[model samples]
Target: MGPRNMAQGSSQKPEFFVNPEFITTKTRAIADRKRENTPVPRFTALVPRGHTVPVLNKNTLVESPDGSYRDGPSTHGTDRFERRRADIVAAAIPVLNDQGFKGMRLTAVAELIGLRATGVTYYFPRKEELAVACIESGFAVLDGLVAEAEREPDAGARITQLIALFTARDAAVRQGEAVPLASFSAIRSLEGEHRDRAVEGYKAMFRRVRALLESPELAAMDQTDRTIRAIILLEQLFWAASWLCDFDIEDYPRLAARMADIVLNGVAPGAIADPIPSLTAPARPLASRDESKESFLKAATRQINEHGYRGASVDRISASLNLTKGAFYHHNEAKDDLVAACFRRSFTIMRETQIEARALAAPEACRLAATVEALIRFQLGPEGPLLRTSVLSSMPVEHKTEILGHSYRISRQFASMVVDAITDGSARAVDPMVAGAMVHAAINIAADARPLAMAQAPDIVARFVRPIFAGFLAA
Candidate 1:
């Protein structure tokens, strides 16, 4: 089916109908008010008055005295239909972020807004449609931030401004003034035209961010350098939301400044020569002794990385390995078991690499650099592409918590290394915790760099890992 048709309900097709009175008296007035006061752009596009598409003004749904959102008089009188739809979108954002598209349930979203499954289906017939809407809203929010950042005089200033704006918006979300941003990692689980639209939107946002590095001062960098840096910056921003909860909301601005400092100037000391170590040895094999189970996990990890946890069905995993369903069950008890195993395998590989890198006779900074380079190389290698951390969203709460505990321990290990680097005078006096988290984020995101040819591992490490150690603007 086509993109538009895929979004329609089986019994009734969605119509682009909105009441004119609501547009003039409510939506336009709010838009005008927001335009006059807010320097940053609003979340979604507001179609002109009398347009066929309904006005989706998230600002109009105000919180009542009881803390629940109550529709305005115009919404009750004229645009109840559209208002209800907007409410569903707002409620679904957090659910989608937590559960991913595969785990997101229409009934769960319905419960949040006190609507039946049928009620939500009336607005968004298919869950994919609702998911697409959530993803689009996320893109709109990011586009607004990028637009605000573009006003800065240079790339460094723009990057700093971007982080500041993100933290401010995040603070607003915490204060209940805005909706939570949707997670884009699960976009891979979407199929057909829905996936196409989401991917296009993401690429558009990526292009805008990549353009930030196009200033005359940064003109010496090639497109490949810019692309790697842009992805690092964007991934770090996305990853920030996951860990920002550790600090009080009041510390957001301070955290943003520190994060920007790390991104712009990096963690290396000014007098340090060659932040990256010359590690010519090949990465040690990350596979387990059980070749049969290892084969299953390798295929499963690749599938999960590409199609998400839910989309990576037992059938798909079996077929990828030229094995039958019986074979899958013979080795694994259930799909969740497989997913948990993948997470364990990934964690083991990371910890082993860290241990090996630390054992090197090299300086602390070189050990950290070697660790990151080895991980990136493994990501592009044959045994490669570790399970993405995004899969944690699709997992059950208990499983997710356990996995997160493992992840935290690994991150703490990295933090210790950074502390050592600082003490040894090889790294700058950056927050070891923040720097470690950033390093963890970068390594986790390296699995997404599968398109980079294995032959270019050295250049990829230079362009990607070097930037993380030394600043993004480093020659």
Candidate 2:
């Protein structure tokens, strides 16, 4: 009988195959034939009782008397599963970037891919597992780019190449040709083994990027110099995703070239004697009316920076301050209220420092240097550590909007300094907006240097700030 007649008229039971290889071959044949106007032959697969009936295609399977379709594990089936899992991860990355790990919802991710929550859990089992996957995917992409950059002959070229590659990838992502890169802001929100793995992956990536600055020409740069430079480079790239959206995709290459110039040959005019001026004294503490409330805000900012909004519970914040939850409620009505206050405190510090630097009697370039040095000092000082902009991802939309507005104002202030320096011919001609954004990124990431010994503050500024102002390859 013909295949169509056999499927339609046969009363006899079809043979069931127990071997997966045989099932795979037979399934492919039937699928191929079905495309040629041939009917798919009925087939059954032997599965242990209570086991999930393997399916080749949901529509192609035939149900038996026991209501089980005949199918077995096959290469095609596994490939399909992997593709589905990838689709889910791709959908989850943008959500993670926008809402943070604390705000990410598995159901929302599933909905984006037109799947049920159960469909996602079938692969990831838990939200944490899915988050880890998303983070690891980002790491994989970064590692690939770094590997490509390593092929360059020198540190400067490698750094430039890396920036260009990242800009290209980001442009592709914006164009929807690739998945969005996962933000590392919420890595601290992961718990247990996941957090450890993520941290280790980050360290590995850092080490690799640092190696890019190890050529003989840069031999004078010690490990500390390399470490600080690596941190600045990585942080700027991380911050790029936030602002890169402001420009058109067609301008990415130009933007990348400008960014590479800023990194390689800072905003200074023909090599200055001292790219970064030494601060005679540490930054004075920002005046606060209520010391106790200031202490609470500092503690809360640290907790939130380290553990994310969801992970930084009121109990944790209170415990950090050696206060009871009642005391927290007494000072702040809600955690969000305290976070808002922390943001305000951070903005106040930046604004006051800008005002102080603007009033400096030195040149515009020196004024800019003083401003960066003071902010970095404040980041490393006691009662310091301005809130990281990453926390904006975990905030409510209204709060995020308000904080971002304040942040842009501060960035524009730095731009004003750059404009002044350019007009005075003390700084190189560069994009003021981009230069300002780089300065903002530098100070924001200064908090990362807190782990280094306090005595290294000058060293931090020399290796970190000078390279930023004079260029990474500056003498």
Candidate 3:
């Protein structure tokens, strides 16, 4: 369910992992360019040898849609089709890594087999279906790694084995051989049964890690903190794919060993983590303080976006606006109320965005595209901080449920637009629910800005919607 999934591969693939110096240089280049308001420079990561790259070649001996060998006579299309399906999913893993779920194009997969987009759909029917298959496969691979790691007799050895699993995946990413699940955010793009299944898949993975952490050895730690520690370790492992690009691929084993040591024993033996610092608001002009609620909400939104809900202190929110804690109490009963209020304000803006999209006097397809574009622009703009929905998971269950209801309503509206487009022949026949979820997902992708590079807002939005409307292979 993570936006990206892994492929089943041995942990012995040798490749030159991206060195830290390369990443630092790229980061500095991007920062300097952003400071000058210049477009960010884009570069392609090297794809690992043997990982198929999509290229159109008619002479290539590729499997046909019905599982026939296009170059010669073959068996009936039953088992071959399933194998082909697996191949398509494998091909897509790299695309998902490069472009994400929203930015991924089915055509890329088709090109891997020298087929058209329609040919790919003959099997998947809908893009979401393909995504599910890839995600399931990826998670299954991860599950296997966890199961393997569990077999190790020593707890530290077990942890090292698990770290090695991810380290291998990280190298694959550097060489573009696989996708890292850490960057996977497309889980929120699923709806109804798909969403339920995906969420459960995520929970299962989390539970596996939690179980590993809860192994009798760490019994002295608080259960809640143990869970947090498990989450933190997993997060660090997930993101290691990104950071590992800067280190020699050969160092992965050493890196995994060191990581295992750090996780099992603090960097400083017997040391405890320090408290997270709070965000303080900068000096605001007198005009801003008059609307205390608005000012506080803005400050809180920024803080929460950066540090998460639990980290965003109510005390800090009040201080950011140069107001006392009493000023916060006067405007809101508690931090929960403030968070709820923030969710309301964020979703309201989102709903208004859809409303504005619908109000436009244009074809349904155009309207849908416009609405998505508007939402993306809004998410990346100053209001972007408010759109961080990660905080909702930390909210009281009732509050989370209420806010989710509002979120789903908006998603359904997007789905409705997709249904309209398909009905009018502006889009191919796709599951409206999945299409809607994808649109929602794409907006979030824009917020993340992973695949967007230096494109203008309009261009970025257009590219984001292209695969959704025109199929990935559309010319």
Alpha carbon lDDT at 163, candidate 1: 82
Q: Per-residue lDDT for 15-127 in model 1, tens only? A: 22222222221122221221221222331222111111112245344223322222233434335564666667767877887788988999988876667899899888999
How do all models score by TM-score?
0.82, 0.81, 0.45
What is the TM-score ranking, best to worst?
1, 2, 3
Tell me the tens digit of each residue's lDDT in model 2 across 204-295: 77888899999999888778778878888999898998889999987787888899999999887342355444443334555655888888
Candidate 1: where are CA atoms >4 Å away? 1-79, 269-288, 452-458
The lDDT values for all models are: 0.72, 0.71, 0.52
The better candidate by lDDT, 1 or 3, is 1
- Alpha-carbon runs more than 4 Å astray in model 2: 1-77, 269-288, 453-458
Q: List the residue pairs that clash in candidate 2.
A: 45-70, 266-471
Candidate 3 lDDT over 149-214, as tens digits, reads 655555555666677666665555454333333223455544567656656777777777666655
Indicate the TM-score of model 1. Answer: 0.82
TM-score result, candidate 3: 0.45
